[model samples]
Structure formats: structure tokens, C-alpha cells
Target: MPPKAKSKKKGGNVKSSTVMDGLSTEDMSKDQLEEHIIHLREELDREQEEKSYFQLERDKIQAFWEISKRNLDKTKAELRNRSRERDEAEERHRVEIEVFWTVTGIHATLNFNEIPSTGTGPMAPQHDGTATKWYCG
Candidate 1:
């Protein structure tokens, strides 16, 4: 004859249909419950601290990016203005050279070369045609 199987029952009067189904949840100790609560609190605190630090770092990065953008914009504007001035000056210089050639009537045979005439001074002029005329200031 075979041995009898173990019974799985909830209460003394009730009958369970599955094996190892007679366990009850009224058995946790008070110390175990307190330790679980403390662990959960520590985890929450650590997460909150990390969130605060990340927020501060993000703000600092945003500020630095804004400053860099402003500086770049200012630099671009300055470069644009400087280029315009340089182009205008070059156009004026070209017109002045044409007028000088027309007025001087230095022979077409002459090999035109620039020769600075002014000896020395802050206001000294730069030359381009004959030994006497100065084309640049």
C-alpha cells in the first residue's frame, strides 16, 4: 500500500486543494517591519539628493550656453561691419587711382610702380605713381 499524501488546509475546519497552500501571513516580527521601513526611507532620500544636484548642473550649463551665443552674435556683427568698411575703402582707392592716371597722363610706356615718398611722421603719405604724387594716406 502507498503512504497517504500530506493535506494543505487553511484553517483547522477548512480544506485546501493544493499542496504547500496552508501558509498564513500573520507571522512577520516587529523588528523586521521597522528595518524594511528604514531601508525604504534611505533610498528615497538618496534619490531626492541626486535629483537636486542634476537640476543645479543643468541650470549652470544653460547659462554658459547663453553667454557663448551672445558673444558669438556680437563677434559676427563686428566682422560684418568691418568687412563693409574695408570694401568701401577699396572702392574709393580704385577710383582715386583711375583719376590720378587720367590727370597725370604718365605715358602708357611707363612701367607704373608704387614708391612711398613721405620721409617720416604719423601723417606721412604713401605713393603709387611718380616720385612726387602720393596716392594713399
Candidate 2:
């Protein structure tokens, strides 16, 4: 038999060159390659788990933003409704004041000879639903 082949060192470490020379791409079986792939998959799964925690917090913030937007919209709607009711009440009060002045002027014009005095108004019905009281001279 011929003499055993001598190992050649290319880099500074002779042991690393020897170990690399012993391994070949075709020497590893399919099962060993599959085991490496499974290890890589496990590493990827761990990384995703870490990222999911931050993703959950982002989702919560988004939900809060949506709730805040809805609350703002509801406040705006309520303010608009209250403003409309106030305008209507002011209009009704203006009409009642105008009518009171017109009636007092008519009474004064028709009774120029007599002294003006405060007149009594009709009695209002006493009920829980009707809160108006009768005025006396």
C-alpha cells in the first residue's frame, strides 16, 4: 500500500484546516441537513415571538385611537344639538316679548281717558303637568 496522505495547512491554524478537509458537502446525509433546517426554523419562531409582543401593543394603541376619534365625533354632535335647541328657545322668547308689547300698546291706545293699571290674568289650571301660575293685579 502507498504511504498515507499528508494534510496541508492553508491558514494559520492547522487543526481548523484539518477539520475542514475532513468534511465535504456530499458527505453529510439528508437527515443531517434536515436537522439543520429544523434548528433554523426554531430560531425564526423565537424571533417572531419577540416581535409579537410589540405588535400587540401597537394594536392596542390603534384601538385606543379609534375610540378617541369616536368620542370626539360624539361630542361634536352633542354640541351641535345643544346649539340648535338654544337658538330655537331664543326665537320663542323673542316672539312672546313682541306679543306682550303689542297688546300693552293696543290697551293704552284704546283707553286714553282712563288711568292705566296692571290687569289680572286668567287663572291657570293647577296640575303637575301645567306649571303656570295666575297673575293678580
Candidate 3:
């Protein structure tokens, strides 16, 4: 069996022989590690900011979609109401025309006297020289 190489530490409590992924921290100097950490933090901040911007855009789109849907619903309701009102008005007009035609037909069927009345009123003498009278019993 072969003896394994002993890992070394540079300073403080940071172990230089720590393994991350396939790369060993033993080859990286202290300054390099600190710079890598700072770069990673900056990259993380940029990603978080991008995520927040995307979230805000998504929220705005959702709000706009909701408003559009509500307006569409209102427009549809108005159209339906107008259509119903128009139909009712048409029905009323049709009914009025039918009633007018019926009344005109009834008037055409009736018989009316065309002779002018005498000036002596209802007690006037008839053409036969007899006084005309009426009795309601």
C-alpha cells in the first residue's frame, strides 16, 4: 500500500487542501480564493437583479392581461344588452303594426249611416206627415 500525501493549510482556519468539484483549493493562493469569492458574489448579485426585473415585467403583463379581459367582458355585456333592446323594440313595432291593421280591417267591415239629420231633431215629422216619437220601456 502507498502512503497518501498530507494536505497543507496556509493560514487561519481555511484548509488549502479542500476539494470542490474536481478542483483542489491547495493550488489556489489566498488572494486568488478571495478574488474568486468576490467574483462569484458579483455574479450572484447580477443574476438576482435580473430575476427581480423579470418578475416585475411578468407582474405588469399579468395586470395588463387582467384589465384587457375585464374590458372585453364589459364590451360583450354591452353588446348583448344592445342586442336585447333592439329585439324588444322590433317586437313592439311589429305588434303595433298588427294592431293597427286589425283595427282598420274592423272599421272597413262596419256600416255607417250617410244621410244628414233634419233640423227638427228626433221629434221631427216623417215624410208620411206623422210626428216621429220614441218610447224607452
Kindly give the stretch of ten consecutive residues in candidate 2 with the minimal lDDT sum.
123-132
- Top lDDT: which candidate number? 3
lDDT, candidate 1, at 37: 60
Candidate 3 segments whose C-alpha is farther than 4 A from its true place: 1-23, 106-137
How would you encode candidate 3's per-residue C-alpha lDDT over 1-137 as one tens digit per residue? 89998988667695446554556667777887787789879999999999999999999999999999999999999999999999898778667756976887643222223433364633233333232332111
Q: Give TM per candidate.
A: 0.57, 0.45, 0.59
* Per-residue lDDT of candidate 2, residues 67-118 (tens digit): 9999999999999999999989877866765688688763312322233334
Q: Could you give me the TM-score of model 2 versus the true structure?
A: 0.45
How would you encode candidate 1's per-residue C-alpha lDDT over 1-137 as one tens digit per residue?
Answer: 89999989775695333222242223435675566568769999999999999999999999999999999999999999999999898789768777877899853344334543446543244344553433333
Query: Residue 67 CA error for candidate 1 (Å)?
Result: 0.8
Candidate 2, residue 2: CA error in Å?
Answer: 62
lDDT of each: 0.67, 0.63, 0.68
The local distance difference test score of model 1 is: 0.67
TM-score of 1: 0.57
| Backbone clash total, candidate 1 | 0
